[model samples]
Target: MQAVIIAALVIGIPLAIYCVCTVKREEIFEEGSGKNAEVLDDDGKITKETTMGRIIKMDKGMGEFLMANGLHCVTCTSSANESLADACIVHGLDADIMLSKIQKYLDENA
Candidate 1:
């Protein structure tokens, strides 16, 4: 019927769009959250698995902590390939403590 087709067009189109958008958003969230990624080690340490630049991009507060702890490398081009633990070691910092601080911050905000 004409009424049925009109109703389907009015409702089905938006429903389909919403479903597609929701799926896309979920995919983006999964990638950003690093669900199955190697962001952390088996011992729960932030190791060379993830780069400092990626961490900084995840949270600006984390970036501030890096700078406050004398890690100016976050702004350097090499930072893209520099792991958090490597940066901590190069700056004479304890990577475990730094990772703890960052985890705490994320937990608190989350």
Candidate 2:
């Protein structure tokens, strides 16, 4: 029994640590990738249904804006699947207001 417990701990701890490190490394790579470039094309529109990952990929500067507004999860892998409204709800922010602000940012910056 003791040997089983020891083996589990030895395997579990390293596996857990590796999983955490892999997630962080992926976040770093995604953030540094050319996908995060500032050059916006026709697809750069911000809408409530637009995924947070799509927004960030459209322009890295927008990611900074999102982080400032407490949506720091923009860099997370989950953001790829999370829309602006979904993220705002999860973050306890008013989705409409956040969307408006994001629109204004795009308008003024564009």
Candidate 3:
């Protein structure tokens, strides 16, 4: 009886974790679904991923893009709470231009 319990603990736990990790992890990173369209780049790459459904998944590429374009606020932790539109408004950055440039780069590379 004890041997069976030990075997079950080892095998069952691993199998359960594997199944949960594989199945649940994909759901966490599917995509955005709001009206904002997830702030895609010129080539349809996700710039500011707005899908805060399960966990935070900000588009790191967008942050790099903003920093490259002189928008330093992209690195701030506060950016996690703020939307792309609001950040542009506060930082006096042109959201359209930034987005356009990002998308263009994406299109070219893709």
Judged by lDDT, which candidate is best? 2
Model 1's alpha-carbon lDDT is 0.64
For model 3, which pairs clash? 41-103, 42-103, 42-104, 43-103
User: How does residue 11 of candidate 1 score in lDDT?
Assistant: 100
User: Candidate 1: lDDT of 90?
Assistant: 86
What C-alpha lDDT values do all the predictions have? 0.64, 0.70, 0.50
* Number of clashing residue pairs, candidate 2: 0
> Residue-wise lDDT of candidate 2 within 1-110, one digit each (tens)?
99999999999987886677557635644564334333334675467877776676654477678879988776566566788899999899999999878877767765
Give the runs in model 3 whose Cα sits over 4 Å from its true position.
1-61
lDDT of 3 by residue, 33-109 (tens): 22233444465455443322211243324344455776555434444456555666777877667656655654554
Q: How many backbone clashes does candidate 3 have?
A: 4
Q: By TM-score, rank the candidates, best first.
A: 2, 1, 3
Candidate 1 error regions (>4 Å): 1-48
Q: Which stretches of model 2 miss by more than 4 angstroms? A: 1-45
